[model samples]
Target chain A: MFNAIQHYRLVQRNRNRAGLGSWHFEWIYKFFLHTGTSRRKYLVEVRQYDEHLYTVDFYAKVHNVNRYRLRTHQHAAGKLGATVLAIIARTIQQDPQACFGFIAAAMLTETTDENTRRFQLYTRMLELKINPARYKVEAFAENSTIFVLPHGLVSQPDALQNTITRYDQIFREVF
Target chain B: MTKYSAKSSKKADPRQQAREERKARNRAIAPERIAKVHIMADGRKLLELKPVQIPGYTYAF
Candidate 1:
């Protein structure tokens, strides 16, 4: 579990590299009633938005479906907000709560256009192996950065970067 | 809900056992050998110095 800075940096860098102007992103915390006929589950929704930002819940940067997110969040909520919501998702499991194995974050596409982003997500689906494939990239456009979320994301490039390096020190001390 | 600590201690401590870990180190020890080194420019203390031999260097005995 590293700092969220690197994640922000990469997202910013990717935006710059993709020539999307000086982009800005903030982490949001939201929950959802993830139900599919046979299975009923809760999911954590994370995303980043731009321009005239306002507090919202169940907001959709995509089409039709707007997820249930927390409204009126503190500006500093950041990645921590995303993580707490993920924990909620893990706990709601009936048979196996927190039993999805390793921690991972769903890369909700850093590129533009839903179709193209979905294709990118599909082509590089291996990176999303650890993250839940529930939400399609174009389906939801939030911060496309990494969080020490309760899913599978252990790649070098797909990692969250932070200004602080205490995680290593913490690992050394704890492990 | 046991705990993250409980699951960890089962295989920690020993690995985190703090030893005199060489943080940063380098060695310099001159060995007995005939080599050209700095001589006294005063010409009074000019003497043949030996070559420096570092530790862990293999030598034909």
Candidate 2:
């Protein structure tokens, strides 16, 4: 399926096309992929980990896609780490008590140290076993919070705002 | 005339079916062992850079 959130390759088209503003909370959690008769949900946090992969849940049907360009000379086709994570938090708030919880926070520690520091905020606060330079799994299921660290990462206000709007619209439409 | 019935083969071991389903579910969560990235350039502008593996939480690839 040619889905916006492509990693999960969720077939939500035609007979299953996402309704208008279907990206919202209530409608999304209804799927077997997100809710699936569980009391836990997943979240994402991305850092400037690399170019293509931002950070996401391996099993879950959503992958972070960067919309904003990095400050460097690299193309911006990758998932905007921060905004993707924010969308994840919105997805989790959908139920707060029904889905099996997992978090997909990531950082690109390979290209910059700033991402490493931002991620440390969560690791130090939540005491997560973070080894950005060494972590490879794109899915983790332990902490209540996730962070994204990126190398040569630059903050984008528009991306952050758009992410929030996506969540807000999702909340309004679904609930 | 002998009637052939599909119901005779309809019964499956529920436990085994459940196990298989669980296996399928677990398989979905696996991450790509190797994440690949390619940066394309068009003149002075870099065209693309994206990770070819799953996003977020990092585990042993």
Best by lDDT: 2
- The residue-level lDDT of candidate 2 at A159 comes to 41
TM-score of chain A of each: 0.18, 0.23
| After superposition, candidate 2 runs with Cα above 4 Å error | A1-20, A23-154, B1-61
List each candidate's DockQ score: 0.01, 0.01
TM-score of decoy 2: 0.21
Candidate 1 is graded, for docking, as: incorrect
CA RMSD per model (angstroms):
25.5, 21.0
Please, what are the lDDT tens digits per residue for candidate 2 over residues A5-49? 313212222222354533222222211222234322223322111
Let me know the DockQ for model 2: 0.01
Cα miss at A19, model 2 (Å)?
3.1
lDDT at position B29, candidate 2: 22
What's the lDDT for residue B33 in model 1? 23
